[model samples]
Target: MRSVGKQLDITIHRPEELSVPLRRAWHEAMDESPDYANPFLAPEFAAGIGRHRGGAQVAVLYEGREPVGFFPYERNSFGVGRAIGLGLSDCQALVHRPGVVWDMQELLRACGLSVLEFDHLVDEQKPFGRFVTGTFASPVVDLKDGAGAYADWLRSTYPGVAKTTLKKERRLGRDVGDVRFVFDERDPRMLHRLMEWKSAQYRRTGRMDRFSRPWIVDLVDHFFQVREEHFTGVLSVLYAGDRPVAAHFGPRSRTVFAAWFTTYDPELRYYSPGLMMHLHMAHAAGGHGVRLMDFGRGDKEYKDWLKTRELRVGEGFATRPHPVAAAHRLWRRPVRGLRNTVLAHPALREPADRLLKSVGTLRTSGRTGLERPAPRTR
Candidate 1:
C-alpha cells in the first residue's frame, strides 16, 4: 500500500475481495468515460478471472477515502504482470473517475509489479502512452438509434453486401428451416457446443486453442453463471429450426458489448452463418441498450464491411529498468512486427494465411495418423 501526496491511497487486494461499495464506485467511474465503459473493464470480469487464476488482483485507488479508480492485473512470482484476462480481454485501462490521476511508476511500485504488458490498451491512457511500442486500429460498430436504423444505414452504405446477406438469410431459412435467433441464451449445452466448435476452428486455423486450457475453460464456465447489471455473459445463438448453426459468447455491460468467442458449424459455412449471427446480435444488442460493439483488434474483410469506425489500441510493455524486461521485449517485438506486417498487406497476408492453413492441415493429419495407418502383419 502507498499514499500519493496524502490525497490518494492505493491498496492491492484479491479481485474477489472488492467490496460492493468499491464495485459500485468502479461502475460510476466507468460511466465517466466511454473508454472505460467496456464490460472487460468491469469488476465482474476481474472477479471472474480471479476465481480461475490465483494471481489475479485489483489495485484500488482512493481519493479522500472514496474509491476513484481500479486497476486489475495478474502478477507472477517474477514480478511480471499483465492486464487481467490479458489474452482474452479486448479493452484495457485503469478505470478512473474524470478528475482522478495517479503516478504510473508509483502505482506499479505499490502493486509490486516490475513489468506489465498490455496489447489492447485504450487510447485515452496518456499516463502509460510513453511506453507504447505500437498502435493498431481496433474496428467497431457504431449503432445509431437502434437495430432497424443501423440495418437501413448498412443497406444504404453497402447495398451489394447487404442485399446478398439478406438474400442468403432467406435462402438459409427456406432450405435449412425457420432461422431463429436468441439474443440471451441461458442453456449451458449451447455454451459447451460453442467451445467445441471454437476449439475445432482453432485447430483448423493453426491458432492456440484457448478452450483446451483448464483455467480458461473454468473461467468461461464461471462467467456463464454470472448475471449482473454491469456484467453478464451473453450467449447469442443462430438456430435453424431446432439445430444451432452459429453461436457467440461474450461479456456485456450496460452500453458496450465485447465480441469475444464466436463460431459456426462448418457445415453452415457456405451460408455465412457467422456474419448473420453478428448482424442479428448487433440488432438485438442495440434494442437492449448497448451502443457500441467492439469487434476487437484484427484485420478481416468482414470487420471492414461492418465497422462504422475504429478505436485506437496500444500494444507495449511498461517496465522498470531490468535485464528481464529488456530480454522479454527483444524477443517479443520482432514476432509482433512480422505478424502485423503480414496482416497489413494483402499480398503477404494471402500467402501467410495459406501457409498457416497448410500447416494446420498437416498438424491435424499427424495427430489423427489417418494418412499413414499401420497395416496388419499377415
Candidate 2:
C-alpha cells in the first residue's frame, strides 16, 4: 500500500484486524449519499461475512490520522477478490468517501485482486471507464415524502396495475382470512420460512439454491437477529389465514428498504401475492418514514410494473498485482465477450438462461447431496 503526499494513508487490514474507527468513518462517509443505502456496504455485515468466508482484505483510506473510507472484499482464488459475498448481496462496493480520488488499478493491485466482478455496483464508480460490462436497472419506489404521495404517483403512472394490486389485496383480506402485512418483523422463524420458500423456488426454477450454503444460511439468520438504529434485517410477510403466503427478507436503513430476497407460495401465484405484499410494504414503509423501496437488481416483470424509477448498477473486473493477471484477463476476455454478446440480444436471453440452468443441473447432479428437491405443495 502507498500513501499520497502527506494527506492520506492507505493500508490493507486482515479481516480480524478491521478497526471500529475505520468502520465508523466508512459509514459516516457513505451515509451522506441519498441514493446509496445498502447495508452490505456496512462494516458489521462485511465483517460477519469476512469471518465466515476468510481471506477478506479491508482497505482503509485515511485522511491524515483519521479514517475516511473502507473497502471490504474477499480474496477468493489465486489472489482474485470481489465485493464480499457478492452473489448473495443485493448491493455491492465499499462505504467510501463519495468523491474521493483513488486509482482503481492501484487499489486493486494493493488488495491483490484479479477479475473483481460486481453485479450490483453503484453507477457513479467510473473507475472502469469504458470497460463496464453492462448496466443493470434496479427498480425503486420513492417514499421520500410519504406512501400517500407514492400511491398517488403509482395511480398516475401505472393505474391499471396499481388498481389491480390494491383490489387483490382487498380480496385477499376478505377471502384469505385476516390478511396482514408486517414490516421489519423481528422473527427468526419467519426468516427461516422465507428461506425455505426461496430455496424451494430456486429448485423449481432449476436455479442454484443459495441458502444451501451453510455460511449464507447462518449469515441470514445472524442478520435477522441483529437490530440496530440504522442497520436491521427486515422480514415483511403477507399472512393469509395465519399462514405467510408471501415474504420478503431484506436490509433496511432509517429511510430506505432494500428489497433483497422475496418468495411466495406458487399456489397463491394467481392472486399475485408478491406484488400485493410489495404494495403493502410501500404503504407501510411510507408510514414508518422510509423514503425509498429499492427492488434490487434483476429484470423481472413485476419489478417493471411496480417501480416508478430505475437505478443503474455497473460491472467490471479488477486485476491483482501479478504477472499472471494479464494472462488471466486474456483468458477471461472470450467468456466476457460471449456474455456481453448474449446479453445484448433480446432473443438470446432465454437461451442463455437455459444454458445456465443446464450447467447448474450438471453441477448439481455431479455433486453429492446437492440434488434439487422435489416441488413441495403448501
Task: Indicate which candidate wins on TM-score.
Answer: 1
Sequence-dependent TM-score of model 2: 0.85
**lDDT (Cα, tens digit) per residue for candidate 2, span 136-216:** 787888864444554575576458787777677667778777677777787667877888888867765667788777777
lDDT of 1 at 98: 92
TM-score of each: 0.93, 0.85
Q: Which candidate is the best by lDDT?
A: 1
Summed over model 2, clashes come to 1
Off by over 4 Å in 2: 1-6, 14-17, 145-158, 330-344, 351-370, 373-378
Question: How much is 368 displaced in model 1, in angstroms?
Answer: 6.8
Residue 77 error, candidate 2, Å = 5.7
Candidate 1 error regions (>4 Å): 145-158, 366-378
The Cα error of candidate 2 at residue 128, in Å, is: 3.6
Worst 10 residues of 2 by lDDT: 369-378
